[model samples]
Target: MEDSDDFLRLILDSIAENIAVIDEGGGIRFVNHSWSQFGSDNACSITQDWSKMNYLSVCDSAALAGDEFGMLAGNGIKSVIDQKEAYFNLEYPCHSNNEQRWFIMRVSPFELNKERFFVISHQDVTERKLAEKAVEKLARRDGLTNIYNRRAFDEILSEQWQQCLTLKQPISLAVIDLDHFKLLNDTYGHQIGDDCLIAVSALLKNFARRTGDVCARYGGEEFAVIWSYTTLLEALVLSKALLEEIRQLKIPNERSPIAPYMTASIGLVEMTPNRILETRDLIAQADDLLYQAKESGRNKVSSLIVVPSSAVENQN
Candidate 1:
């Protein structure tokens, strides 16, 4: 029995992850060498004679402190100890002053001589977590302007639509188009055109300050903004401000009649939950209004608030 215990401790010390064994009573039975080193390296105030510290008590303290993740951890640990769950796993950030870190906590229950014990392991997963974040960032962002991509914008619109449906709030969308952009592109070559697109995208992105606000490349020389919880007048004012900001860019477009510098037009629609559910209709309406902006002469904004009674009744 003694030799077996020594072998187990030796194996635990060899591994990297911090490992500890806690009994059913929540008493810390044992902690491996790596566990002590982790606390020392992180300047954790937890003592080496971990028996003096109760894992369950730490979780309870965290929960009382109103840490959501800590509450989850406490619940997960209880589930394992009660044999209600096979194992508990949680990935969480534990950044310290010296280093940004993330860890994967795993708790598995085992029985020896009819006595229950839970093996807790903490594995450093910072590199993997950071890499995953980088990949996710790339997936959701536009390559050109480093703003949300069209796909992300669509996702946000769908989410906001659902929220508005439930809360009966208003959401607005604005379609922005560069006037005579094709002429500018044809005259100055694609490089300058690309520069203009980047600059304009940056400007539009800056306008998305509010939560759930999304600015995306709708298509070539065109951008779109989804503004959640906005009224018709608010949408119109924002669109007009965006139009003015684009003109202020002052990128010369001699080929256009609107101005010596570049200009953009905006078409906006503010819809409430008591309106049609067809997001496509909203886009089409905005597009039609954008055509009107171009026809009425560029460098302007056009907006409308619409409600389809039939859809509103269905929604109700």
Candidate 2:
């Protein structure tokens, strides 16, 4: 029996995953060698004597401090111990100061000497998670300019609209159209036109540095910008500056009647969200204003603020 116990311990200690066994009351009864190594690597103070501690108590303390993963882990372990669940698993991030890391925690029940115990194991899965993130980013990006594609733009606009509505903050939208783009493409080849688009997209990136700001390729020669928690006056000021900067790029467009260099028209709109309004309504208003700007002059900005009828009546 002594030799059998030592053989079992040797096998458990050789496995790479961190493994621990806890009794019915959640008291840590055994831990493999990898468990001690993991604790030391993470700078855990209690690694020296894990058998003297209650695993559930540690999870409960972390839960009280508002660690969401701790709460989830504690509940999952309890479900297994109570026989309500045959197995349980959870994937969570456990990033260290020097590197990002992810792990999958699993719990399973076992019978030992007429008593029930749970075996917990944690396995590293950071590589898989990072690959998934890279794939998602590629799906959301435009092929030509490398900015966000139209599909991503629509999704992001809807998300930002809801967030701004919930926070009772203002949201702004800007629709931009390059002036006489077809003429430029006709004069210089499609290659130069593509280069111009890339340059403009790069410039747009600078304006979207704030959190919740998004710049996307709406379509050929068209782009859209969403600004969360911004007012009409603020968006208008930025729109005017964007026009000036595009002109400064001095991408020659001798064929354009409006100017010797390339320019753009912008339609800007701002609104404090309400239940009666939808995201499409905001896009429609901006599109109409953009058309008006093109009709009046090719290189200018037209802006409007949308307010609820009740608010307008109160002001009157």
The parts of candidate 1 lying over 4 Å away from their true place are 1-11, 37-45, 60-66, 95-100, 159-169, 210-212, 257-261, 273-285, 307-316
Number of clashing pairs per prediction, in order? 0, 0
Put down candidate 1 lDDT per residue, 1-316, tens digits, no spaces.
Answer: 6569798789889999999999987889999999999889768898558898888889889989988778888899999998899999999888888778899999999998999999999999999989998999899888887777878877878888888878888888888899999888888988999999999988887788888688988888889999888887787778878888888889989979878889988888778754446677778877877887777887887777777653211000
lDDT of 2 at 191: 98
Candidate 2 lDDT, 171-202, residue by residue in tens: 99999999999988999999999999999999
Global fold similarity of model 1 (TM-score): 0.80
- The prediction achieving the highest TM-score against the true structure is 2
The true-versus-predicted C-alpha distance at residue 300 of model 2, in Å, is 1.4
Residue-level lDDT for 234 in candidate 2: 86
lDDT of all predictions, in order shown? 0.84, 0.91
Q: What would you estimate as the lDDT of candidate 1?
A: 0.84
